[model samples]
Target: MAFHRIFVLDLAGVGMGEAPDANRFQSVGADTIGHVAQQWPGDLSLPTLQRLGFGNIRITNPIPGIPPVEQPTGYFGRLHMAAQDNRRATGLREMWDYTGPIRTESVFTTLTAAGYSVTLAGPFLSYLATQTPAERFQVGTNQAAFQILYDRLNAPVSGLTYVVLPEFRFAGEQQDLEASAQALQMTDQHLAQVIHDLGANDLLILTATHAADQTFGPTPTREYLPLLVYSPSRQAGHALGIRRTLADVGATVLENYGVAPATTGHSLLNELTQ
Candidate 1:
């Protein structure tokens, strides 16, 4: 499970499907991914994510300009949140399998506490990234943050590293889905930039802490989340079509280090080549 390096990009609130129990949260009609694309007033395209199996997640309406690919280049699937409350901290904890309420720890705390050398970027993880970088790129537009990350990718770093983006959340909150689509495009374009710079020995994980509710429609939106893994190591075409939880992600990260996650989760290491 030990990898030479692992990079996690948390695209905050880029939701895919509706949560099964969205009715109570007043978001039963939530489908941030779908809603954003549907209401987007302009052409939309995320060819990078589409190539990674994003389009395959939906059967009926694919995101605005994103269509399902004939064959995906990486592992693709959906993650269901274990808790009813959907917030950043809650989702981050769940990524590492913390289902208990009133918890104050996360995968970051656990991994670093265990003596893993780590470098972090973005606002959410600046607390840790600050341990190294002089200026943390935690606050800014998606374009701004990504510009920094694009450069950081070329710099040498060991152990676990992370990059967080709140722009999606910011854009998602915009009254205009067109604005949200623009943010999505900007992020994807940057993602493509950094992804190409990744080395063959590296593992890149793309996920969202949770989906959003930008559109408070009379109809509920989907609460499903997207998980895309980009690695030259993994063969293409296989899909990890199953229901997983955010905590499972934390567990998987731990698993990569040959450590067991406190919460229940199947290691995705083998699935990389599935």
Candidate 2:
């Protein structure tokens, strides 16, 4: 089977363990944990995704951070880390067994080709980097940026299914987990409003890229992130379990739609759908 719509969200600076429901939303992956984790997802629009075969894509209020510098590479190395996200781990000239757009693009592209209409939306790294003067904040100093990103995704266009995504991992860094939880609660309210505006019975999948371990004291440690699968179609409330890897998002989405589960990550559909 195929899902009529799909959504992929990449959040910002989400560490491996942090926050009230730290397990509910954290980003993991050498790429995410090492590099992209510090940045927000890109501001790719629906038109871009459609051109890339997705029906729609939106990257909302991405975090702020500087991208790594690029370096010259030898023949094979150049072919390896050419993709923006991959360049951080593989470096200038070195090939891993798998070299491709291992970020969100890889998963979305695969689903698109499989006949699933896709939408990508999220805040971008450059946008987020601009938030602070400490360097690497690209999200402009305009409060409107966040509101606009959310507003623009009000509904799905023809031939495309709409998905509003927000990764709230960085919230823990603002003060303490309490403040972070409040922020997440606010974000959840906003997202809930968006969903309601889009119409009742719309499918929703909320996830944390990985986890973080931030404390206001003299200690920190890695922890598991949380994943929530909410489908009005089924009246499902919440599903619990630490997604072991970032690729788990892809796998769960495929399973949700009845498509052959993509060859990545673990599947939580059984727990989520049943």
Candidate 3:
């Protein structure tokens, strides 16, 4: 069950609920997915996510349409931001355990050093350009980003591919609940294709850097982001629980490649592989 390829999909602004320290940020009761589902005209169809344990996350806090299933195909969990604020840059850095003003090393660099090909796509490409030695592809929209990622997944290669979809973030910023819900549906459809195209050795991690709950305001909200891990080799899905930091993601990736993790978070590789 060793994974030769890992795909990290950052569905920006897709938060599940408020974080433990939401009050300090004046973001109590902020639930990106919940709000979008409630305000959305009808039950949001997310068959792909449901099969991946998206509904299981609602066992603690409910999302309108997604409900807990008897068995999920992947691991489900939520992650808390380790940074003081919910900034995009801070969240991304925390994923690799970077806390300094200037990041010297990251998951991308660590993977590259281990001889893994790292490819990054989406709007964050320029922001992360100087951090890692990766094959970067800048895309304009979420659709374009996912298309590029789909194309890469279909290629005959095994490595790490990271893509960030900003449409949700943009919709959240604009405070358009309808747009946000629509984008979620569209993303879910695209996710079905992505899952269908995944190879046996491919590992897919879906998460968010920060929550831009339109109901809260234009700024990012302090909220718990969704975490979904899927691989064809896994027999059944289980709850990963609340991760203290997003760095666990990087740790898991490094562990899969036999590279030691240089982060504060523990690796979930064992849990997923066991």
User: TM-score: which candidate is best?
Assistant: 3
Q: Give the C-alpha miss distance for residue 145 in model 2, angstroms.
A: 7.4
Where model 3 places Cα greater than 4 Å from the true spot, the runs are: 98-104
Q: How many residue pairs collide in each prediction? A: 23, 47, 0
Off by over 4 Å in 2: 1-3, 7-105, 112-119, 123-153, 157-179, 198-201, 216-221, 238-242, 255-261
Write one digit per residue (lDDT tens) for candidate 1, span 1-274: 4466688788877788677777767676677888778776665778887888888877575766688888888677877777767665666656644432455445665666666655556655524443442234465566666665666567665456666686776666564566667877877787787778877767887888767757763222337788887777667846666556776676667777754444565667766763
Instruction: Give model 2's TM-score versus the native structure.
Output: 0.47
TM-score of each: 0.84, 0.47, 0.94
Model 3: pairs clashing at backbone N, Cα or C within 3 Å: none
Off by over 4 Å in 1: 97-105, 124-137, 217-222, 260-262
Per-residue lDDT of model 3, residues 158-265, tens digit only: 778989887887898799999888888888999999888988888999999888889888889999999999998787889999999988888788778876544467
Candidate 3, residue 74: lDDT: 91
Tens-place lDDT per residue, model 2, 83-201, is 22321112111111112345333334444555554443333443222222211212322232335435434645311222222333333333244433333434444554544443333
Indicate the residue-level lDDT of 13 in model 3. Answer: 83
**Candidate 2: residue 226 Cα off by (Å):** 1.5
- Weakest ten-residue segment in model 1 by summed lDDT: 126-135
Using alpha carbons, what is the TM-score of model 3? 0.94
Among the numbered candidates, top lDDT falls to: 3
Q: Each prediction's Cα RMSD?
A: 3.8, 15.8, 2.2
